[model samples]
Target: MPSVRTILALIASSVTVLGGALAEPTVALPATACTTGAPMTTAGYPIPYYAQATPSTGAFENGYQPEPRWAGQHLVGTYTFGVPSPVETGFAYAQFKCQYYCLNQSEGGSFFVRADSKVGSYCECYDDLMDPETFVNNNQTLIGAWNAICKEA
Candidate 1:
């Protein structure tokens, strides 16, 4: 038989080993870091009819005209631009597209800004001419399209 002191020592060693085995391991997580880059801004606007078409001449009436598919409430367009850091280039491109390609009275407008070093910065504009309900339903599709565009860029 083991001596009392030897049994006590064995029990203490087993307890110590078991305690270590049952204890949770400690994990050292990385510290949270702050964003050190400059801030970005995104903006959008409605295009005016006058900017989309030439003035009416004496012989011909020249004004903004929508295609048959885009006649009433089924028009949609998206424009995207990328720059080093600032959002002005993307904003300007979106504005230009709205002025030249989108309907004069765009009912819905969406803008997104992304700041990334590998992907750089992106500004996106979505021009929606559909009815409110239709636009709402197609919102997911618009977001997916923008994501695709952003990934490609």
Candidate 2:
């Protein structure tokens, strides 16, 4: 004995609930994963959406390379080590370009890197809301390292 609109509303509510249950959760990273209070600059505009180190082997999206230099082409730095939301940045860059921009570009992804002494690092690149300035402000250690290492190079 319900109105048609009421019945439609109930159906929509059920669908929403089911959808919420099926949707994947966003990636969350520890504050410690990123360096705190380190200064970072976009001095090199078009910061290479590629890693300086070799890209590890995995089910990566297209256009990723393990080595920075290959066949007279050098992949630039997509991110500085220990940056907040590197994973998120990677994901956004991938979607924006339709290609993989960093290692482990998936949510809940992890990888081993030379930096952090080869410790396993998690991918935190899911959020598209972060801007470059805000990212720099949030990740001090990463910026400091980039300035010292990448900028100097």
Candidate 3:
């Protein structure tokens, strides 16, 4: 028979191994600061607005305009022309805007634009899309476009 000390040692070893396996894995938090590495460009409108008057009737303009949730957030850019698939096209446009316009124009940080309701023709920008605090405060979740464009940031 095993001695009491030997049994206690084995039980302690098992608990240690089980505790490590059962413990929640540590998740790597996103960086608090990030840079897009794109040169700053001309600062345009602070928030996205209809560059042109709202069209009377169109699939893209369903009279639904997504307003900016963040105050003093710069309008990185707008994507009016969307391909057949709004999600894919929006994502691509987001990447383009982030790389060329948002990174350069807006303060160096994370941002993303996506088509929520409007057809492929309309897209809006959300600055600090990857910030955890912003998400918690605004009750906003990171969209796929953020992953496509702002993941680096």
Candidate 4:
């Protein structure tokens, strides 16, 4: 397990950048942790968990617009195009305060990409998708584009 300080350090160093500009605001992001009792992923990966609390800013939890979805809840960014996603920086912003924070946020669970023009590493599970920065200097996690990466485990 990663220490909270380690996770926060990853967040700070791996913040995404666009044209060399930090896309994710310096707002306070929370520490996320998950554990699985049974065998986890078929690949032996970490199971996901939710840290249900509003940060300093970003979308609300479980509320979508132009559509009703997700545990009868939705967030503010769901309807608005918050950032240019799927790219390193855009994914950072989304993960930082992604309208749909996790797999449960959006029904599609992927969308809000950084525009097809841009691209970045798309990790599916573990902290790789949700937190990204652990291994990247400027990685981002795009939403609403899991069709290519999603599959039955």
Candidate 5:
């Protein structure tokens, strides 16, 4: 017969295994669009916004804070920049179908904004750090769309 110590050990091990199985499952965030090295699905899709070779990590993807216009805009996203350690600084454009539009913290980082035209043929890019990003329809079209989409909010 097993001693008390042996019985206790068996019970403890069983609890540990059962606990893990009973624990709630975790959900995964959506993948980032326009990754630097990933191959494009087709000639024009996925688009290449920016790419850097570093240990950069992004937070969990979430819905846009202020929200955006358009029905297909990404509702989940994560920012990839922060203070203390700065990354690259430059401007690039891509027509990506992002799951969420990333936001740049005020401290510093590569902040980007996107606005798609109604025709779906053109997309406007903006730099969160500055107001010098490319503009289409003199910003009216994008602003109107955003307002219209976020109106219910």
Candidate 6:
């Protein structure tokens, strides 16, 4: 009893909804981990992790990259920095954690330009354009821990 146009419109709507149903579910993106604001947590644990380099948005929480080493030691496998040279230049040390590939981009190094902002402790944020951020890491111990975690991962 439906008209031609009405039937066609119904078929099209059905196809669109059915297509979405047949498609695989999308994965959730990682969160930010900048220091300008207080560290955040999921459930109860801290979302501490690193990225290969700052993301396009340049927020730690936006996404996470894994580390690959501790201090100057090797992690496990050969890795290529996901970011560009300009991003690397800003990092103090760089590496990835071969063990924990699924855990925070494998414990890779960060591109922080501070003297106090480590993993846990709050500081400021860093940027290649604006003035230096206050959450960037500055503590040697934390940096060491970061590298070590990357190696173990």
| Top-TM-score structure, candidate number | 3
Winner by TM-score between candidate 4 and candidate 1:
1
Clashing pairs in 5: 62-76, 62-77
lDDT of 2: 0.29
- Each prediction's TM-score versus the true structure: 0.22, 0.19, 0.33, 0.19, 0.20, 0.19
TM-score of predicted structure 3:
0.33
Each model's lDDT? 0.34, 0.29, 0.39, 0.32, 0.28, 0.32
Q: Compared with the true structure, what per-residue lDDT tens digits does model 1 show for residues 1-153?
A: 999999999999999999988968899964321112222222444322211111123322222222334323333443444442244554444443433433332323332333334543333333432222222111111121110111111
**lDDT minimum window of 10 residues, candidate 6:** 122-131
Q: Distance (Å) between predicted and true CA of 117, model 2?
A: 36
Better of 4 and 5 by lDDT: 4
Q: TM-score of model 2 relative to the true fold?
A: 0.19
Best by lDDT: 3
RMSD value for candidate 5: 16.3
What is candidate 2's CA lDDT for residue 85?
43
* Per-residue accuracy of model 6 over 50-128 as CA lDDT, tens digit each: 3323323544432233221221242222332232233332222222222133233332333322222233222212211
Task: Rank candidates, lDDT, best first.
Answer: 3, 1, 4, 6, 2, 5
Output the better candidate (2/5) by TM-score. Answer: 5
Q: Tens digit of lDDT per residue, candidate 5, span 1-153?
A: 999999999999999999988968899954333222332322233323332212112211221222234222433333221211111111112223221243221111122333333222122222221112211223222111111011111
RMSD of 1: 18.6
Candidate 3 lDDT over residue span 12-106, tens digit each:
99999999889688999655334233222212212221111121233232232223444246345554444343455454544444444444444
Give the TM-score comparing model 5 with the true structure, all chains together: 0.20
Model 4, runs deviating above 4 Å: 1-77, 84-87, 99-112, 116-144, 147-153
Off by over 4 Å in 5: 1-3, 9-13, 20-27, 33-153
